[model samples]
Target: MRSSLIIIGFFASGVVLGLSGKLPNGFDFDKFGSYALYLLMFLAGLSIGSDKNSWSVLATHNYKIIWVPVTIIIGTLTGSALVSLILPSLTMKESMAVGAGFGYYSLSSVFITQLHSHSLGVTALLSNIFREVFTLLATPILVSYFGNLAGIASGGATAMDTTLPVISKYSGKSYAIIAVFSGIVLTILVPFLVTFILS
Candidate 1:
């Protein structure tokens, strides 16, 4: 919770700073942002790779565990399709592209902005942010009603980080491995899926 709060606070600070238009004149956010994202992704990969427990959990679990991330992908995209019907303005592909973010807002929004319109990029950012916030707030209720896997699903890509603590608290430590695995798979797929759909 404290970590989540700190992250949110930093994000809020950035927003305020950006909106203030007081940044240094020579700062090249566009050029630097992509490099920063690459570094972040590399660090995330290192974190996962260095975790011995995460690997052991995979080795112990049934091979069928692969289905978990697949189920999440299907369900998320299906829900996005339904939402597209209501939205009317966004096509099915566009909605699914946004949904493909799976709570990894930073990369998704940046990728979408580069591939598509700025408007769609904003939609992806907001949608993924909402996903993370909702998962954080509702994981306990979701776990109680729908089970641990539901909590993982609700977390999307954040199952590996931001929402992982909430999921671990409500679901169980054993399930942390599953969350990490699911998050890694979804995180890897987001950029490819979103780019493919947009293309």
Candidate 2:
């Protein structure tokens, strides 16, 4: 909870700084943002790599566990498709494209903006942000009712980072490797799936 609070604080501070428009000249926030994201990804990879248990856990788990990520993909796309039916303004493909973000809001929103429009990009951003928040808030309850796997599924791609703490807390330490693996797989699929559906 403390870590989550710190993260929220940093995010709020960044928003304030950006909105204040008092940043030093030539600061190049965009470039800095990209570098920061790259660094985050690198650190995530480093942590996973350094943890020998992650690999061994996967090795011990049955290969059928692959269904976890597959289920997440199907569920997200299907939910988006259902929503598109209610929202006539967005085509099935466009809605699926947004859903493909799978909680990786930053990269997914940027990708959608480049492929489609700023409006759709904003939608993707908000949708993925909601997914992450909802996952974080609901994982414990979901775990109680549906078990650890369901909690991990709720996290989508964020299982590797932002939502990982909540997932680990509620789902048990044994599931952490699964959460990271599921997150990595979903994260890799997000861009391809979004682009493919959009195209």
Candidate 3:
């Protein structure tokens, strides 16, 4: 929640800077952005790999439930592909990359910005952020109509942390396991998926 707001603020600040034409001259933004992207990816990997609990969460989970995240990914990518055919603004690769973000806006947007263009990165950021926000705001209605797992699916990569509390409240404590499991799996896949699609 707070992080989303902070990202929006940063994006808005960047837009303001660009509009003001105050960016420093003679600096290679492409080179700097590439380095920054590499650093962010490294740090993200380090943070996850260093956390023993992250692996433990996966290791201890029932393998049967793995299908949940798998299904989410398939559905997301499928929808993205279909949308690509409909919307001329995005190609199949671009749409797939955007969908690959799931709900991990920060990491995915950075990857897209580097691998694709800033415009596509902004689209990924908005779409992914909306995924999380929709889950947070509509969990109850989602769970009520579409069932408990619907909330989990809507939560996407945020199910494990940001949307977990709401999901727990509406979907019952039993489903929290599935939510966290799917969230972690999707979060882990975001960078790999985006890079793969963009490549």
Candidate 4:
């Protein structure tokens, strides 16, 4: 909990500093945040890259991993959609935004904020935080019962960052594949997904 706070604090501080005009003139803090995200992904790749066995397994039996992501995506969509329907005020697109929390909060929030408004970003941030907390709390139990995919889905996009260690420890080496795949796919999907939702 403390460590998580520290990590989030750093990013949050960056936002504050950015807003305060502490960053160099003409240097976009938002763009810096995006670059930082990529760097984190690169480091995650390095960590996973060090494990040859995991990489080999991913290369050989990649199809098996897809089921996990498919299940997670379906679950997120269902959960968010159900919540939206129950509320009756939220739109389907808003529901989808809420459901995508598998660590996608920052990017999604930033995207929504830039394209739409701060309110949408705020919604995305809060929902994503909820999603991540749920993932962290349920990781041990879910890893035992629902398996790696559920665990991965719990962390959402975070499986590629600081949460990767937790995932590697709890879900085993196999999940590294899912983490990398989800991260890469999500990274690419961000712009497209946001555009679709905004439109």
Candidate 5:
């Protein structure tokens, strides 16, 4: 929760700076953002590699384990597709592309801006951010009504990082393992799926 607030603060600060023209005119956010996205993806993979539990889970070759991510992808895309019916501003593909972010806003927003429009990129950024924030704020209610795994599902890629602690506290250590696994899978798929959908 604190972390989310801090991130929002930083984002708002950046917005204020940009609006106030405090940044240098020659700064190339596009190039810097590209490199940062690559670095973030590398770090995500590195973290997954370092987690022995995740590897152990993968090593078992349990087909059922994949259902978590599979279901999440299906659910997110389906919901996004539904949303597109009402929001004429977004095409079906664009909506699904945004959903493919799975709460990994940084990479998704960058890819979206590069592939489409800056407005849609900002939409993806805020949409994914709200997805994560909703998970963090509503974990207890989600767990109470929807079950433990629902918290993990709500968290998306954040299940491994920002939302993990709340999920762990509410869902227990066992479900925490599943959260890590789910987060790892979603984090890895975000870029590829978003790009594929947009392309």
Candidate 6:
């Protein structure tokens, strides 16, 4: 229900943007969108931060859960490598940088747009947007079957921050600990990973 509402809201905003011709003119959104993303990221940080016990559980658990993130990284690397291979001349670093954007669409789109030009920015933005949506929809099913680790990874990088509530909802209290840990680790890794892959 919340996801549906979010999707609806975005769709409505898209309509408004189209009708008003008020789409962001440059890499930056009008102040409102920019602030909203910042707030969202901050909220994610706050949510995860407030839950210290989750981290303790993660440390206590057999580190087997680590594989969940490892698989996610591997998937990311494989996708980046394949894209680079197909593009041939595109270096591994560049592909990985693109991959590191890792579905953190809003900021990635803004930065990529500003740095690389609008087209690549749009690609980054759209891919991140889709990844978020995909993760949102997939969370329940993944948690039910593949378990919390897989569910968290399904959100890819967004799991670090924005997707916690959803993960918590589906995966239960224990998942919160994992979610916080995942969020921090991924948040720290995203920029470096993207740079490493892209550069």
Name the top lDDT candidate. 3
lDDT of the candidates, in the order given: 0.85, 0.82, 0.90, 0.67, 0.85, 0.67
Tens digits of per-residue lDDT, candidate 3, 1-199, equal 9988998999899899989998788988889999998898898889889988678878975777898899999999999999999889789999999989988998888889999898998899999999999989999998889887988998889999999999999999999988888999899999889888888
Minimal lDDT window, size 10, model 4? 183-192
Which regions of candidate 2 deviate over 4 angstroms? 1-61
Report lDDT (Cα) of residue 15, candidate 1: 81
CA shift of 142, model 5, Å? 2.0
Q: Candidate 6 at residue 84, lDDT?
A: 78
Task: Assess candidate 3 and give its lDDT.
Answer: 0.90
Residue pairs with backbone overlap in model 2: none
**Candidate 1 ranges beyond 4 A from true positions:** 1-61
Highest TM-score, which number? 3
TM-scores, all models, native as reference: 0.76, 0.73, 0.96, 0.66, 0.83, 0.61
lDDT of 6 at 6: 73
Which residues of candidate 5, in runs, are more than 4 Å off?
22-28, 31-54
Error of 4 at 158 (Å): 1.4
TM-score of the candidate numbered 2? 0.73
lDDT string, candidate 1, 92-131, tens digits: 9999999999998877887887678778988988888899
Which structure is stronger by lDDT: 1 or 6?
1
- Select the stronger candidate by lDDT from 2 and 6: 2
Worst 10 residues of 6 by lDDT: 110-119
Candidate 5: minimum summed lDDT over ten consecutive residues — where?
A: 53-62
Writing each residue's lDDT as its tens digit, candidate 5 over 1-199 gives: 6765776787789889999988888999888877876787788678768978766766657687689888999999999999999997889999999888898877788778877888888898899999988998999999999888898889898888889999999999988878888888898788789889988
lDDT of 3 at 104: 90
Model 5 backbone overlap count: 0
